[model samples]
Target: MVDRPLSLYCLLLPSQKMIHRLLTTAVRGLSANYRDVIYYRVKGGERLCRTPFAVFQERESGKLSPKARAAMSPEALRKQFEALSGKKRATYAAAARKNRCEIDLRRKAFKQASLSGFSHFIKTTRQWTDLGRRAKEKCCAETEKIRQAAKVERDKMVEMYYSGNAVKH
Candidate 1:
């Protein structure tokens, strides 16, 4: 049997067991590269299939259909936004603000963690006191500042959402 790279379409068989069966029977004596491709393609296809909408789309057009494209366009989105009631618009804005705040907080925390490298050292030594007073205090102060900012943002988001007010910025 001639060894050829498997098509992605072949891996899209209805059942995973079918792919496994094909691999076991047809992939024997194949080069390591071919086996690896089959393994990864099957795994990747399985991952894609987990999302039903994506699987349906793939089975249909393998790309966004015209209706999907139109629905996702900027003008369509603006029209959809315009159609929402005032209260719903405020709620959506609040949710977006909250999401942005959370992402910013996570980024700040990650930056602080990387800069301090204190967590790694603490984990290894199991001794917080091993860090010098100045470094320890600085790290604590920075972390506190980030926490306070996040709390303030969260409170503001909740207030705006409940009050049905749009942020003026």
Candidate 2:
């Protein structure tokens, strides 16, 4: 065995210690970049990022009558959306970001679960398939034996039938 020297920049945790990494946009972005990830403690709390899976953008348009903006064109709609983004943007950007990150995590988790389920089904069914094949072979062998016996009995009856018909002739 070769003795490897540890680097000064590396700090390793014990084997028994488990650190849970919460799903966050920061984490996802780091993953996307394929870079080493670091996380700062959340503001005012030690809890990591936990959020809802859905997000909806709040429309910032004022309560002006729908009668005015009903026939707006594409450019006009963009302008309206931009105007809404500037002034009345909701304070939920943080929550929405967290929710989006959670959605990404959920999608990843769901995909993993689906793959694992399919693999498990294939493994379990393989045994049943083997059992079914063996049973079929046994049944076919037994049926062949019965058919051979019936053929032998039929041949004996044919000779007896001919002997009785000879007396009638």
Candidate 3:
């Protein structure tokens, strides 16, 4: 059987019991996304991540370990690296703040005009409010009308049954 795909938002839902995350790569040391995780369950509620949850696990590396490396020569290591060609072994070179700012400025404008401005926001919000009110009013009116019609039909049915105006068919 195939396991259903779990949504990121589904993890935080009210009654969901379990949440699982697949380990892509377990980066070592303390970065922004690496921390010890703990889970807990409430008596009346659901199981939740209780502690700091940075995704971490023992990462299975492609290259062989140092103890296993004693038999292999320099050529073998080079061949292994070549085999694992695309995996990045180091962090990116962080550009200076000044350079970053300059690049940002060159790439895009500082201020941007939106398709929907302040007036549009007000209009849209008012329209939503109006639409909700209209829908509520319409539902109430229709339900009341339906109830009244049902009552009238029921009264007619009773009269017909009593007056011998209808058969079982």
Give Cα-based local distance difference scores for all models. Answer: 0.45, 0.34, 0.31
Which of the two, 2 or 3, has more TM-score? Answer: 2
lDDT of 1 at 149: 63
Candidate 2, residues 127-155: lDDT per residue as tens digits? 21234666656645654554565455444
Q: Give each model's clash number.
A: 0, 0, 0
The candidate 1 region of ten consecutive residues with least summed lDDT is 39-48
Off by over 4 Å in 3: 1-131
lDDT of 1 by residue, 13-118 (tens): 4563354345434543545533322222232232122232333333434356778765575555566567768886666566456545544553344333333334
Ranked candidates, highest lDDT first? 1, 2, 3
Minimal lDDT window, size 10, model 3: 49-58
Number of the predicted model whose lDDT against the real structure is largest? 1
Across 1-169, the per-residue lDDT of candidate 3 in tens digits comes to 1143344324333432221111112332442211111111112221121111110001212245767656766566556544552423221111123334432432222111111222222223322122466664654565455456545654443344345454321
